[model samples]
Target: MLIGDVSRHSGVSTRMLRHYDALGLVRPTGRTAGGYREYSPEDIRRIFHVESLRSLGLSLKQIGRALDDPSFTPAALVSDLIRWAEDRLARERELLERLRAIDASAPEGWQGVLRIVELMQGLNSASASRRQQAVLSRPEGVPMSVDVLAGAVLTEPDPHVAGALRWALARAGGDGVAALAAGVRSADVDVRRRAVRAIAEMPEAPDATAALADVLGDPDATVRGHAALALGGRGVTSAVPVLVGMVVEGTGDVEAAEVLGALSRDPGCADRIVTALADELAAHTEDSAVRIRLTQALVELPGTTAADLLRELTHDDDRAVALIASAFVGVLDRRSTEDRDG
Candidate 1:
């Protein structure tokens, strides 16, 4: 077959076939009377082979060595090809994520796009301070999309930077709750913890409250504790048990107690909060530290129920529990007097 017939039959372009001939990847077996290139059946087969290798991302040089060099081994070359393909794939994925983030930002102009790009670069900077500045330095009127903020919050390992990202998310409003909600269920413990913490700072919304509620049973105590505290602040009665548990365990018990006291502002909730504390006290009679923390927590509860519990605890067997309760009782009494006089 002539070069034209090979090109037509094998799908290799005429220019490419000539280039392959020049590179010796595929040369014609002979020539016609007019001195045009001519290809035998075997030469046509080699042309097909070169095109096949090219489809696997082989460069022309690599293809030449692959077809002509007897010492060439496919193992190392194939491994290198795999690595190159993987790297290209990773770059494409990263580029897609950046584009998605920019698209999500809904930039109104080239300047807005530039600002989002700068913010993304800042958030991804190697220096923690730069990442923090990126989040804190968003342009005054251009709000970051919730997903962008939530993504940074989930991956941020620096506590200070994480705090700033959480603050930025909170300032952006509660829309990030959904994005953070996915992080709450993450298999990574740090991701889950960060997610709950960020969500805690979000303004109370049904989705935010629901996200907190979902993590109440998390295996990690810190995650559960943060969720419970946020829920308590939102006046979600379901957080009462977790808050009470935190008090008993003495993990963040002070903040837990404060939230319980805030929750107890409701007359109906006041009794339940007091009763839960009393139940913990009754259950942990032998554990003095537990009793003391629970006792201290009771002081934050409103109404006379907690004060009554405190007065009764003053006579308990543990000296420390008794003394703390006695001290708290006096404090509650003064509060009562101040309320009455006013």
Candidate 2:
């Protein structure tokens, strides 16, 4: 086939074909008598294979070496990739261990207690962790060591480990729920925060929303923030009003702003976000970050009201905030002018 034909068939431009050929990555099968390049069906197949390898994060030079080496087997490449992944996991585990040790020696605080839990969970395998979770679910006749492990796991720093505990709690049925509820009530703020996060990821059962909502009132600001974030992740739209209330009433808490920003992405929550932003801007004059974020959140929604708010924010008192707002307004204006011209 001609170069044009190869380009059309492979969805790669003609220029790229010449570049690949120059690099000796994918050479055409033969040259025509008139000196034009010609590619065979086999050449196209080789191109596809090269592209596949490139997609797997292999550089052109590495790919060239691999193609040149006849001893390279698919199994060997796969094993290499697996080893890389294992190395990454090892590094993560090491970091978690160090954090855990620090938390252990530190004075009794939410961060320290939570770190211990996170450390224990990280050390256990999925199967062993699941078994510990099972014991937590039962809470009765379980060994003291298992119970202690369960408590520790609940405070595990890794969200994945906490998620496993929540899964076990759900599977344990009524008894598990009771134990999980106890975790939420722990004096250690980190345990409560992790519990809220874990429960948010799990399937919403009876009283789950109410229980999470209660955490929004926890004395610790971090606990309230996690609860808000968890509720957002769970898509608990029923909590929109409560989230709006927090954004307005929970001044000095950036977490509420984050939750409101998340909720603003949903059309159902757009109006509440607009109202909250308006109220916040009016009540707190120095909160430029909130104003900027609020403007951004509003622009993501569809409707004239949000557009109007963005326009007004473009001239806000805060220079940084005004710049962001102006940029969005400029984009909309340009688009509108382009539509008119077209």
Candidate 3:
């Protein structure tokens, strides 16, 4: 087949085919008697492989090596590809997260803010009263009372009403904490679960740290998961052990993976984080959101371990992971070049 035939069949432009030839990525098998380049069926196969890898975000040099190396296994090539993909996905997710934060904090009219504040206060007062009643009535065991309250708080007719309830729970004092802590023992799963979420956000509360640590052992996975989230938000290093334990025990649980990923962000937890990812114990179990979080956390690690793991992840089965790894590689490469110049 001629170069044009290979280009048409491979979906690579003629110029790109020439460029690949120049880079030794998919060179023709030989030249015809008339001085035209002739690509064999094998060359066409290589052309398609090169095109596929290029589409996957491998650099020309990387693609060339992949083509030249007969010893490179499919898994090895895919692994390389995953690193590139993971980096790209990480960059996109970071941008998206920043956008979300901006949207959430966007300026609103004074009237709107005031209305939101009023709704929050009212909701908080109502929730506190209900919680106090539950505490007084059920002191030892409440069937579904906590669940009922949680349902009311989360499913409130208005967004402002829900936000208000959250704000009020966040601001509750000693009595509020005690009531919530007691509620965690409620027989109603929903009640215990919601209470855990509310309590996690009370980072400034006197006993918030201890309360969060206690809930880490909640029988309900949702409660335990929320506690992990709260620990991250509170930046409480005390929760690291519990979180890591969760990672080890719940290696296949997506929620546990999310928490482990978050824990990896703290500078103090870098070693543990890298160990977890490198081991690939809980790494592949991560859901899309957790994978994004993991990529971000991995990017924060300072050593070659992080880079190597990321490079490995570039060929992950998950496309999102691969994209993020690619973006990370780009960032690392840029930083490396910058340091060399400096």
Best by TM-score: 1
Candidate 2: misplaced stretches above 4 Å?
1-152, 155-160, 167-176, 233-269, 331-342
When summed lDDT is taken over every stretch of 10 residues in candidate 3, the lowest stretch is 139-148
lDDT of 3 by residue, 18-58 (tens): 88788777789999999888999898888878778778777
Candidate 2 at residue 209, lDDT? 69
Clashing pairs in 2: 117-152, 117-156, 118-156, 118-157
Across 1-342, the per-residue lDDT of candidate 2 in tens digits comes to 988998898888999889989999999989999988999999998888888887876778778878888886667776787788789889998677656544434526665455445534544545655644443443443222223334545656655555656555455344333446877899987877766665665454566667778877788766666666667656666555555555545542455556555666777777766776677677667877666656655555555667788888878888987899899888877877898999
Quote each prediction's TM-score. Answer: 0.92, 0.47, 0.43
- Candidate 1 TM-score versus the reference: 0.92
lDDT of each: 0.88, 0.66, 0.63
Model 1, residue pairs in steric clash:
none
Model number with the top lDDT: 1
User: Clashes in each model (backbone N, CA, C under 3 Å)?
Assistant: 0, 4, 32
Q: Report the C-alpha displacement of residue 198, candidate 3, in angstroms.
A: 1.7
Put down candidate 1 lDDT per residue, 41-83, tens digits, no spaces.
Answer: 8888788888899999999999889988999999998899999
Alpha carbon lDDT of residue 172, candidate 1?
Answer: 80
- Order the candidates by lDDT, highest first: 1, 2, 3
